[model samples]
Target: MKHRRSIELQPPAGYAIETERQALATLPQWFVMHARCRACRHQTPIERRDVIRRCGDTLSLATLARRLTCRGCGNRSGNLLLLEKLPRD
Candidate 1:
């Protein structure tokens, strides 16, 4: 089946080393060094199912990428703390 890509070029279809680097650049050293949730200030693994549940299915690495919205605050991570890490290729 053909995968779908969002306008921003993210969504399983968005996996690219450069794209991942750009995504990582948006984050701070503390986030990459320490690693934590941009939402609720919760320091946890992004791989956790609950985190995925909170961020919605589109945030998944399995997908290309999408706008991350918090279920609790109804806020987007684009505005919230963007704690990003470079994915190893």
Candidate 2:
């Protein structure tokens, strides 16, 4: 008999993703990225292709967060990036 190790679906608290590859590894096709503003509690979906195109694949999430601005409040402070799985049809 053979056994396979279970994969971790969720990241631990204060988990820092150093690169896009680390964050996207084993991510399902239904999962999409979003940026949530801490100051105003605003959330918006982000296109992964566009981000990779603009920032390249090696950019860290922390650095990307610092680069993003809240569209709702026009705040320049860092926003939280999240990977949310969408419902299937």
List all candidate RMSDs to the true structure: 13.4, 6.9
Candidate 2 residue-wise lDDT, 1-89, digit = tens:
22356655565454433445553333456768889999999999988778878778666666677788998999887678886656667
TM-score of the candidate numbered 2? 0.60
Measured by C-alpha RMSD in angstroms, how accurate is candidate 1? Answer: 13.4
Candidate that would win on TM-score: 2
lDDT score at residue 88, model 1, on the 0-100 scale: 47
lDDT of 1 by residue, 1-89 (tens): 34365333342443323434343323333333222335565442344345436655344332223444455555454423333546544
lDDT for every model? 0.39, 0.70
**Candidate 1 Cα misplacement greater than 4 A, ranges:** 1-17, 20-44, 48-65, 77-89
Clashing pairs in 1: 10-65, 11-64, 11-65, 12-63, 12-64
Top candidate, metric lDDT: 2
